[model samples]
Target: MLEDLKARNPHIAIYPVSDARFSKYGKVLDGFDFNQCLDIMQTRPIPEEGNCYVASDAELMGTDVAGELSRRFYAGMPVQIGYCNGNSSKLNALEYHKGSEVDVAVTDLVLLLSDIRNISHNELSSESVEAFFLPANTACELYATTLHFAPCKTSSDGYKSIIVLPAGTNAGLDSIPAPKCEEDYLLWMQNKWLIAHAESIPASKGAFVGITGDNIEINY
Candidate 1:
């Protein structure tokens, strides 16, 4: 599958999530059992088109590993459990939170990632992006500095991934505040800062247009 992905997307680098190249962005998580969580995720519905993200879900949080995740992975910090299920295949946008995000892939999927450090004057080039493949049932953590968005599908059946984050990370803000710095303009939701491609849906919704170059689409 990885070789097929590489052959089809020859213009960019693609690696398995276990590769050393993934270390800079985040680490492959271990110790916690994600079976129960994966089971719950299997029941979540994928949208007929595009993607659907739930910031938090009670059932997902009720899993036994949720407490272990909070106590161990998050160091006692309050966290939310949710899922992103979709058929998306484009690099529509990139977003980062102030804390690490844990993802447990319920199915095989591809993630388009970049480094926040590469941003200059609030803009990032699509050329800086790299792709990583996450196989079914694998879990990994994306650091606060890792720029990411919805997972791209690796097959026509679409994809499902369990998302863990500090509570309220992607919830809508009650009020928009005035920008205090250039980065503030990229704030799209509570604790979520984003840079959208000019052609993305987020761009049309007024997200800061900061991605420069082609809005990359993965050919399945």
Candidate 2:
């Protein structure tokens, strides 16, 4: 895929995260210290305005979505036993840890709702940018401190990842309120809080600091 990206000259990385193994407790093998980011699939509607934005800071931008490939294709899940992929709809949303920048990804299904359309990718040879349409139920982990885009999730069951980045790291901006013309279009927020720099990672000054079962102040 990397070669394909290079041949296509998109100047992007399409690394499919090889399953690094899940922990005994079943959490996906956690390692990167990059800032975490995620959002819950909006399950309910705004009680105040039936069609308008609610004032609550927590009003979500999501809906019921799940893997559409489960019925027909080999929606692989490396972490599971029987199938390559699990009930991805049951997978958790995007997440980032403290001290890391959040990486957002997105896709468009409303564009494919009719099943007769094709996603448009504007490819180039220079270091420009491109968008993605993560087939529903697909989740990816960006390498530590890697620059990526606001992810596009079309699963009605919702899709996301919680990120954990270096302390004091600058993360990309919230993707909910992208510019009017940019809405519904997957974009790599180049200047937001989600993007991070080497200086922002945990100071490799003394020892390593990691999260424990309960507390966070402990240092290793």
* Model 2 stretches with alpha carbons more than 4 Å out: 1-13, 19-144, 152-220
Q: Candidate 2 on 170-208: residue-level lDDT in tens?
A: 324354354355212222232222211122222132111
Which prediction has the highest TM-score against the true structure? 1
Q: For model 2, what is the alpha-carbon lDDT of residue 183?
A: 18
Candidate No. with top lDDT: 1
Error of 1 at 148 (Å): 0.1
Residue 150, model 2, lDDT: 25
Per-residue lDDT for 1-220 in model 1, tens only? 8899889998778899989999999998888998988888778988899899998999999999889999998999999999999999999999999999999889889989999999999999999999999999999999999999999998899999999999889999987799999999999999999999999999999999999999999988
Clashes of 1: 0
